[model samples]
Target: MPNTGTPPLPDTPDNWPVPPPPRQEPDQPEPRPGPNPGPETPDDGVPDVDGPADLPPNPPRVA
Candidate 1:
């Protein structure tokens, strides 16, 4: 076959041109905390309930 003038394909992976590294995005600033944040505390104005303690105790089961 006659040569087409184009360079022959690389036989090994090492012969190929290395690709450019991926672009990196700029770092974002952390958010600032407001007056009140996170979970609510008992002293946050609303009264706290007794929860499970308010329920009646279970009776013992006989064999």
Candidate 2:
């Protein structure tokens, strides 16, 4: 059998190309802190979040 040589490697620094410098984004006005809004409530002033009564238990997974 004839001898086969390995292919040449790409030109890279430590097998990785040099990354570009981080980009600079334009500055925007700083946000003014205030009272954070709470989650929405129903007209009856009660949260409509799900509870154990919301859904049936999941079926067992098949092997």
Candidate 3:
């Protein structure tokens, strides 16, 4: 006959070390706008030289 030893008992939850709670960072303030801010409008201050109508018609395709 073979003799087998009993297995070790599992660790209890109470014996385990408790970890500390996570720290929270304070909210940061947004940066103020610089003196030379970009133009609000898409065109800025430049005038449009040529309109769509001013362009010449497309030449016929050479098929």
Candidate 4:
């Protein structure tokens, strides 16, 4: 029991390093287009966004 010989693999170049260039979805910061983007209408104009009686009757038991 003595012939240990099986360790040498680093030639990876067929399609290995090419798969890491497709993850470019991280440049997202261009979202500010509209008459209201978000949160801005509480002068009785009503935009509190709750409706359904404000939805808080009973939703706390998270044990």
Best by TM-score: 1
Q: What lDDT tens digits, residue by residue, belong to model 3 across residues 1-63? A: 455686655798876779787876658866776565344434434433332233345799999
TM-score for model 1?
0.28
Worst lDDT window (10 residues) for model 1? 47-56
**What's model 2's TM-score?**
0.23
Tens-digit lDDT string for candidate 4 (1-63): 565796656787863455555556657786875554365434464335443223335777899
TM-scores of all candidate predictions against the true structure: 0.28, 0.23, 0.25, 0.18
Query: For each predicted model, how many residue pairs clash, with residues at least 3 apart or on different chains?
Result: 0, 0, 0, 0
Q: State the lDDT of candidate 2 residue by residue for 1-63, as single tens digits.
A: 564686657876876867898977659866887655456544553434542233445899999
Looking at candidate 3, the ten consecutive residues that score lowest on lDDT are: 47-56
Candidate 4 global lDDT: 0.53
Clashing pairs in 2: none
